[model samples]
Every structure is written in structure tokens, then in C-alpha cells.
Target: MPVAPAASLRSVRTLRGPGPLGAQVPGSGGAYWARLLPLLAALACVTRLPSFRWPLWSPDEGYLAVQARILAHGGELYETVVDRKPPLVPWLYEGSFALFGDSSLLPLKVLAVTAQLLTAVLLASLARRRWGDGAGRTAGVLYLLISIGLNPQDAQAATFEIFMLPCTAAAMWCADRRRWGAAGVAVACALLAKQTGGAVLLPVAWLLWRDGASRRCVARIAAGLCGPVLAAALLTTPSGFVFWTVTGSGAYASFTGSELHVLGRGLVNALVLAGACAGIVPPVVRVLRVARTGAPELWLWLASSAAAVLLGFHFFGHYYLQLMPPLALLGTAALQILPRERTARAIVATGCSCAVFLAWGFLAPRPDLAHAARLAEAVESRTGPKDKVLVWGIHPETYWLADRAPASRYLTAGLLTNYSGGRNGPQVGEKYAVGGTWPVFREELRRHPPTLVIDDSRGKPYGPDRVPSLRRILAEGYRPVLRVEGAVVYARVGRGGEGEGAVRGG
Candidate 1:
């Protein structure tokens, strides 16, 4: 592509008059990227897709994918294979698997990238409504930078937060337009993505109610909120939806998400995000100072979403992913509010351009996923397609790569023990003893009896003496067959069990 001259960039400064600082031609005539900033931002997202040829970094990625794999093959969600989250994320994974097949990471990457790009577009449009063209473009660019750089561990995966963003952005945009009905529907869809999405409804509803919307409009908004929720509820048996999404949810978060133990761990993550937003802090303050700010709902959104970032109790990277939208808006305003002097604006734009480049360049590397392939190698040596295996830890990637069914339906033992520790939120009652469905886990193990068990030590915290039956089952029924990457494997003693020996690597 031919490089446009530096002067061309100046033409993007949209103005009230049809002069030099006005709109340019539609074609690729110098300042094309400026006019098509949103479109370009989306395409940039697509082009900047992460390298999929690595091992999965976050356990949640594999966990959700495994659930999707199960669902794709006709297994039930909460009843058969379990997770405490709402059903939307896994369903999207299910859809991707149907389209791209479950074997490659490409499907998940594609799904995440597409959703992220759409979010960028919506976010930019929303910023433009409240700010201006400069802020809109700036928001789009900053969101892309911060999202991809936020948490290298979870950023690349098709995380629930990633999917929720477009819905949240759309809802905020609709509310900005006083399209109360559309905003309500958008937030309902957001809830389907992840429960944190429910927070978005606060800002939307507050705006509608504060604006003195007509009673008919209020009813329309309420109907939109109820419609999607009711439809999603009808998809599952009423009992299951109530139990998993609500009851089980409270149990799950109580321990894993809301526990104080995770606070210290998350503090660093919060700092990192804050540092990333450092450039925009000044502008954010400035934008807020204006009494008649166009995007008044942003303050409420910031309050709700920022509160959500803290409420989850856990400091997981993806949890912080919830803060991107508000940060992007504020950051965009910061970028746009610079001095109108040509030299000052030019210098600021140049600095921002370099910042985006530096962030993308530096944050592109992923965690070593190569070891997972090795584990898959060693695992496939001992198991086959029909044979079930227990990831006695948190490495669900093993199950995905080996193409085997999870012997224990729960993702990790941590979830099970969470309830016992009183860290249990709503879901991990006696049913999902740890982090999953405990009774079903035990039944699955006893009835099917996995051919091999990969004793992932992550699930090792037996917690206040651990479950005695589980200890006995492992001690008497399974024997250690191998060890790899600090993960030990225990093969079922009688069901095509291997001799007592350890193969160091797969």
C-alpha cells in the first residue's frame, strides 16, 4: 500500500464548515482511513488475530470449549456437563464448533475476533454520539489496544466478557439515543453472555427513568428486558435454569468470585489496567467536569461496571476485561480534548499512534502452549476415543486435544471445595461439591471408571482434610502411570490398566 503524506492526516479533523478541516472524498484519497476509522478499526481487529498455533493459556478457555464439545455431541449443559455461568458463552462455542469443527483453535479465535471487532465499531459510534469524530476514532483505537493487551493469559480466548462487550456497547448507544426499548433488549442479550452483563441494565434503566420517558416507552423497555430473558429461560427446563443461573451461581461466586482471599491477587491486575489507562486519565477528568456532558450515562456506566470489576472477588484477568468499555470511552475523550493548535494535535496523535504500535508489538506473545501438545501426546498413548479420563486437576485442554470425554464433568476440584470452604457462592452446594456437580462426578467416576486419571495438582487442595471417599477411590482404584509437566497420571487399576511405572514425558 502506498503511504499517504503526513498532511493528509489533517483532513480528518471534521469541522462545521466545508473547508480544509472538513470531510474528504469517499475513495482511498489520502485520508481514507480517517473517514473509515470505525471500519478500519474492525478490519484491524480481524487482521490482528492472535496466533492459534499455541497451547491454550487459560483453563477457562479449555473448560468452556470442553463443555461446548459435550453440548455439540448432544450432551445436556448443566445436567450433564456443568459450569456455573449462564449458557450463552458455551452456546456460542457450540455454534463455532458446528461451523469450524472442534479440532482447531481457529473456530474459537474467529468467534472472539468477530465479536471484538463488532464491539469496537459500536463503541466508536457511541463515543462519537457523546463526544465527536476525534473521540470516536480514538475510542475505537484505544479499546482495541487495551483489550488485546489487558490480560495476555485470557485475552486471546473466546471469553464470555469478549462476547458481552458488543451487547453492552449497543445497549449504551441505544440509551444515548433514548431508544429505551432497544437498550433493554441489548442488555438482556448481554446477560446471556455473562451475568456481569446484568450490571449494564442499571445505566440503561437509570437513563430512561431519569429522562422522564413516557409510560408507554417504559413499558416497551420493560417488555424488551423480559422478552429475551423469558425466551432464554424457555430454552432450558425451568428448574435447571433457575438452579444453575441463579441458585448455583450465588454459591459459585461466594467462594471463587467474591472471596477476600483473591483480593490481593487481583490488586496487581487492577494496577496494570490503571497503568494502561494512564494516558487518558487527564481527559477522563476533563470530560466529566463538563456539566452538560452529552454522555451523562457514562458516569453511571462507569460506576456500575467499575463496581462489577470489584464485586467478582476474584482477580482473574478476564474479570478485569469487564472494564474495557468505560475505559475506552473515557480514554477516547482524553485523546480528543487536546489543544486545537495544529502542532499540539499532531504531536498528540503521533504519540497515540506510537502507543498503539508499542502495546500491540509488546503484548503479542502468548504463554507456552507447546507443553499441552506434549501432554496430549503422552495422554493419547494411554487412552483412546471412547475411554474416559479424569483431569484430576484444572487442565481441561488435555481432554480437548485428546478427543476424550471428561471422566469428571466438573472443570476443577477447586470449585467443589469452594463450597466447603464457605468460599462457595451459590452453585457449589452439596450437589457440585467442589466447583462442579459433585454427586454426578462421583457417579460418573464409579459407573464409568476412567481408564486413566491425570492427577492435576491444581485440584489437589483437599481442603480441611479433603473428601475421604475420593481419597479412597484414588488410592485403591487407580494407580500412578506417568508424570508430565508436574502433572501426574493415575490409571484405573483393572480397566485396561497399565503397569506401575512413570513415563517422564508424553
Candidate 2:
């Protein structure tokens, strides 16, 4: 029940259908909002609860949550813990931790669902304003269909993309109504949430200018953008933010055509699905005709979003979440073009819905996270409440799942090998991860050793080209007591007594 900002309120009077003596009704606006928003909110909650209840707990979720937990414990960003994403995501995680406690993944998933619901509401509002209530409701359904449908570990719950979606949709809703200032603020929120989100601004400004908005109005938008940008700069270390979001981000991305190939497959699949839904002709017409009409903003959104999506080689489905709003709108249009009154068209829509969902059934994996739970249980069984643990590899989620502190600042080797570049940084010590190699990890392990270490062979392994830090540590000081789910738990040899020798199912 957070209070709405002055610029953004769900004024229910605007939603009221034509009625006798509408203006004469007392307290009607509140009732309308109370009734309608609740239903939409309830629908959103119900639809997304399945994902929350059956969590996949991806590495992205784990890494982000661990960093936020570090920050929550009075640790500094980059220096205290490492990640390449902007400050806003960690801040959200910190907030979730602060309120819900850092032990379970429930808080983060709840926050993600809340964001998704807000995005759905904004989409519905925007669609309703543009077309009608039917269109608005359809837009909401489409968003949920895409978002909750991809409920696998692919995106998890609250990645940088999911958290930023509400803001992205809010910015769109505002811009669609010519509220440039509010739109700009919302856009800035999106950018702060994730660096990729900044790409949407170009199309936003272009839309404002092309729509003949006055220079003063556009200036207000610029001012709004500056407010958040300046505040974030003042709040975070300027050098750190720039290095992580820009330099580190660049180095992390592979400068190749690998992502483009995957993008083509996704495009083809989406086109085929769209064709099936409204037929090839109507969808094609909708794309062309809608671009020329007042909804030309969709084209700009698509262009900007495409540019953002092509940022690197590894492109996940969450990267495309930003397009859901505009695509939802477009889908609504495609649906509208069909005469639902006719049995043929009705049957076609129903068949398409079933077909699309069936395809998604193949695409999204069922929640089967016994491996993560087992790892967490094993690690928790070995470590004391205050004892720290190190998950050496890509599985930062282990830290969150075990509810343990990281042995050192670094979350995963990828953060070091990928985003990090400098050698003089505080986190770049002799051990843990020096020059993002095994030597640094070894040093970190010896210097501030964790009680229990979970070794993920799936991580960027040290071989002929790299040094074997974890293997060396395992040989020198650790004893494998338990192994399960492609992960090996190494208990510190001398740290534990005779009773702590081995875990069951080793």
C-alpha cells in the first residue's frame, strides 16, 4: 500500500463507463479504482504466484541477491562485492533483504511479481487510453502470457530486466499521453535499474519531438532525466559506476556475431506464432498500418530495443522483456483486426492461444530445483551461522540459498574474468581472483578461508590456459565430504573436528 506519486495516480473516475449523472456521484472515483485495480492486481498476483511458488533460482538471481546482501551488511559496492550491473538493482535487492530478511528468495520474487503487476496495469492503462478497455485488458493478458510463461530459470524472478520493466512500461504510458516530464523520470528510473534500459530514451525523445511537443515541454523531460541521473551520480561513486556500467560492461560482452544468430531464431519463432494468431495478412497489415498511424512510437521502440538487444554475444530471453509492452500493444491491434464476432475468427484466436501456450510449455522448463536445495542444505549443514562460505564458480545462488556470507568480496569468477579490467583495485588481491585468475582465488582462500566451499565444475575452469585455483585449494586444504547435482562440497580439513569428517551421500 505504498502511496502513489503526484505524477502517477490511479484516478478511477477516468475509468468509469458512460452512466447517468456521472459527475453528481459522490466518492465514485475511489470506488471505481478500488474495484477495478484490485481485480487487475488480483489477476496479476494469481497469474504470477505459480512462478514464485515454484522458483527456479537462477545464477543471475543469486548473484544479484548476494551482492545486495553484502551492501545491506554495510559493505561497499565493487570494492566490497562485485557486479557489473548498475546500483539500482542491488539497491532493490537490499530493500528486499532489509524488509523480508536475507534468508529466503521469497522477498525478491514478491518484488518481481509486484513490478510485473505494475507493468501490466500500466500497459492496460495505456492501451485503454489509446483504444478501449477491451484492448487494455488484452494488453495485460499478453504481457502476463509472455512474462509468466517464461517462468524458467532463464530470467528467474527479479533480474535487472524484470525490475526495470515496470519503469519501462510506466514511461511508455506517460509518453503515450504526452506527459513528457513524467515519462522522462520513469525512463531515468529504467536506466538506473539497468544500463541497457537507457537505450529506450532515444526513441522517447524522438517521439516527443516528432509529435510536435513544445521545446519547453521537452526541456521539462530533460530536466526530469537530469534529476535522477545527477542524484545517482551523487549517490554512487562516479568512477565506480562508470567503470562497472561502461568499461566493465564492454569488456564483458563478446564482440562477435553470436548473439545475432540467436536473435534471428527468436524473431522467426515469434513471427510464426504471430502469423498463427491473427493470420499472416492481418499481422503484416497491423505492423505497417500501425506504424503510419498515431502508434508510430512502436517502430521507434522496436528499433531502440533491437539496438539494445544486440549489445553482446550472450542474449537471454529477459533481454527482450523491454519489447513486451509495445509488442503487447501490437498484438492487441492484430487481435482487433480479426472479427471475433465470426466463429471462424473466434476459433482461430482460441486455437492460437492454445498453440502458443503449448509451444511455451516446451520452451519453459518445469521447476526442478532439488539440486540447488540439496547444495544449500549441504553447505548450511557444514557452516556455522557466522561462518562464511565460498561458491567457486557461476553459482552465486548457493550463497543466498545457504544464507551465508561470501568468503571474499567477489561473487563469481565471471564477475572478475569478464567485467573487471584493472589490477590495482581493492578486490584484485593476491588471492581470491588476481588478474581474474586462479592464483587470486587461491590467495583469497588461504588469506580469508571459508569454512565450506561449493565447487561448481560448470564455472569457467582453470586449465592449460588458466591456473587451477580451486583444485589446488581442494588438494591442499579441503576434503570432499559431499557431492551432488554437479557440485562438490569441500569442507576445510583442519577447521572441523572428527565428528565433522563427512556428510551423508558423499
Candidate 3:
């Protein structure tokens, strides 16, 4: 092992003390929790209250829940039930399902809440280390408040962005304290949670070079970064993991909207996000004002996060969640220099953001979970418990609602249609849907055809009418049984009834 030079040692000591980040704020004794508990409780209530009202929030949560159920029942990941994300999130969902039955989405909600709370705590700790107790509290509060400023789906759902935060925050926390190996492991853990988490390494790397870390320190960080990912690959289907996380990701990222649409949506997203996070404005301004004074690492962190947000080109509200923790930390550091009327500015900012989203929500239609519930009820009424169901379009919520297994590995029709999330229309991605998912879809249907096929793609670009194979399958072997809203239910002949009849509207 090599020794850190005297200058490096001094730098570490300085960071350990109150010079840069700040002396560790007093956290011992009863006084700490006494003051902090109310804030945490309020945060939990504000963030999760909406979650508890429903079993599921978004389609993303629905699919992930179904995937978790598949795993809980001894199904393999990527092979049995497929998704184009890294395995950790599904694994976490599996753990939640294992503990609490997969019958309800409460477990998943709980997991999301826990992740957010932990991230806030970690952010507070980070801020306190550099600033003071007040900054720590402010940072934690700002994170919790700003996190939930968006609509329930983006803010409350147990999505990838929500899970990635604590790991990334913790990584920086460790790096700031000069714990290289732990920091590396934390960064890798964040990546496992979400692909964008890989962006966290840039700031960490910059820290290493800036600190002039010893060769051994650098090696430890490298080992930490690679260790978990390699282990995950070894444990699961390595080929599947590589393909989904890397190759498939490329295809998904190939969405290139027209310049006009991109600019329009980008402006809207920016305004809404800025409004929602209005409270953070003072800290943001203060931090930028003193950007050269210290904490270049935080600026790097924010820059990298910004790059990650733009990587997809579709700037969804949740995408902006990645920017909050770094902002909170930097903002907290500038607490000493914050100008007057900070609270009033935050309140006004909050009002503006809320109004923007509220107006947007009213103007634009949101997916009604009630319709899904109705569809689920109809499917459940007609089908037996053992029968598997296949849902067309992106309505995986149907499968979760009906409490049925999916007939195919492709949970949604996106792969079949090459209709990924970012783009508005169902056009093929940069390359054709990774390795031709249609063949796999056909084979799966051939071997084990679904008892009930819910066609939720009536008006969609990838609707059955547009896809020849799907249309033929519907016409030949299946008959329409029921229609609920836009969704048309088809049942396999001989299984559904004596003879084909006109589909009856629900």
C-alpha cells in the first residue's frame, strides 16, 4: 500500500474539520431527533399521502409491480418477465413483494418513501458537513418539498429516479469524506438502480484528480465501481443484462423528435420544473454567486446531472429529480450568504410552480386509473384464475389489476411496435426493435396463447388494425368478448364461448 503525501493528508484533515464542507454538525443525543422528527414526518406525509390513496400510481409502477410478482413466484428476470432496465429495481420490488404480498402496491410505495427520506437525510448530512446545522435542516427540507412539487405520478411513484438518489448522494458524501472505496461502491449501486446514475462518476473522478489521490486510493474506487455490477451479471443472465442495459438502451435513446416539437416540449418542461422547484431559487442563486469560492465538485455534479437529464431528450418531470440533491447541497452551503426574504421567495416560487402544473394537468388529459380498474374487473369476471392474459399497448396496469400472469415476455407492445417512451408516435427506434422482438412475441403466443387478449391499442399508432400479424391473430382464433372504454377484449375461441358474437360494450 502507498502512503498519501503530507499535502494530501492535510487536505483530508481540512475536509474532516470545518474548513470546506464544515465541521460535522452535532447529531448526538435526544435533541437531534426531537427537532428532526416533525420535519421528516411532514415530508413523509406530503410525499406519500397520495400514494396511500391508490394501489398504483403510474403505468411504470404497474409494470414493475408485475415484474416483481413474477420474481416472487420463482420466475427469472430478463428471461421469464423482461424489462429494459437494470435488475436491481426489480430485485428491490421483489424483496418488497416477498415481505408484503404482491396483492397490493403498498409495499412499493413504502419502498419509494423510504428511499426519498434516506436521500434527504444523506443530503442534510452532506450539507451539515460543509455548512452548519441550519443548512442541513434547510437542505433536507428543500429536498423533501421540491421533490413532491410535481404531479403524483412523477413525484410519488416508485420509479428509477426516486431509487437512484440516496446511492448517488451517499457516494458524494463518502467521497467528500475521502472514503474512496465506499464511494465507488455507492456510485455503482446507483448505476444498478438506474442507468443515468453512471453520470455520478464524473464528479467523483474529478474529485480524485483534484485531490491527487494515491494510486491505491484510485484502485479502490475503481474496484468499488465495478464490483457490484460484475457480481450482478454473474448472478443473473449475463447476456440478458448486457443486452438490456447497454444494447437495448441505445435503441431506446434513439428518439429524435422534430426540432419544433422538441423545443416546445423542452420549454414547457423547463418552465414547469422551474416553477415546481421555485423554493430552491434563493439557494441556487446564492451558490452560483459564490461558485468560484469553493465546492467546484457540486457544480460538476449538477452539470453531469443536467447532461443525464438531456440524454433522453424527453424531459419528463421525474427526470428533474436527479438535480435536487446536488442543488440542495450546494444551496445549503450558501446559506450563510443567502439574501433577505428567502422564505417569501420560496413561497411565491411554490405558488407559481403549483399553478403551472395544475393548469397543465387540467388542459392535458391524464391516464385515468379508474378505467384500468374497470377493465381489470371485467377481465376478472370473465376469466379463470389459471388463465394468462395479454395486454396490447402500454397498459401493463391491466395485468397487475387483474392479478394475472402475462402470456409473453414482452410486458407491453412497445417492443413489438418499436414504440418506446420518449417519442410521441410509434415509429421504430434508431435500429429496429432490439434483435426483432416481434419473432419472440409470435413464438411466445404460439406456444402458450393467452386466454384473454386485452387490446388497448384501438386508436394508438401500434393498434391491431395497423399491425397485420396482430390483426390476423385477432380475426382467426379470437372473438371480441367485451369492450371497456377504448379497450377491446378478445377471448380465444372455444375457451370464451360456444360461438363468436359481437363484442358488447361495458
Predicted model with the maximum TM-score:
3
**Candidate 1 local distance difference test against the native:** 0.65
RMSD of candidate 3 to true structure, Å: 6.0
What TM-score does structure 2 among the candidates reach? 0.77
lDDT of 2 by residue, 446-484 (tens): 788888877664323321124344456667777777777
TM-score-best of 1 and 3: 3
lDDT of 1 at 100: 83
Q: lDDT by residue for model 3 over 1-506, one digit each (tens)?
A: 33346633433332233654344566673676568757876675555666666677688888888898888888888788788888888888888878887888787777788888889888877776665566667778767766766666777678788899999998988887788999999999999998899899988887788678789999999999999999988877999888878776664676554445555676776665676676776665644443333567877898999998888676676777898788766555554454446644654565456545444443443456888888899888877888898988786888888888899888887776666554555354323465757778788888998888889876767777778888888888898878999789998998636227778998
Off by over 4 Å in 1: 1-34, 37-39, 46-48, 51-55, 255-261, 286-294, 334-338, 341-368, 419-436, 458-460, 463-465, 497-506
Question: For every candidate structure, what is the RMSD over all alpha carbons to the true structure, in angstroms?
Answer: 7.2, 9.0, 6.0
The predicted structure with the larger TM-score, 2 or 3, is: 3
lDDT of 3 at 89: 88
lDDT of 1 at 410: 77
C-alpha displacement of 130 in model 1, angstroms?
Answer: 3.0
lDDT agreement with native, every candidate? 0.65, 0.63, 0.75
Which candidate do you rate higher for lDDT, 1 or 2? 1
Q: Report the lDDT tens digits of candidate 1 across residue range 144-220.
A: 76665455565666678888988999898787677888988998889888888988988787777766878988997
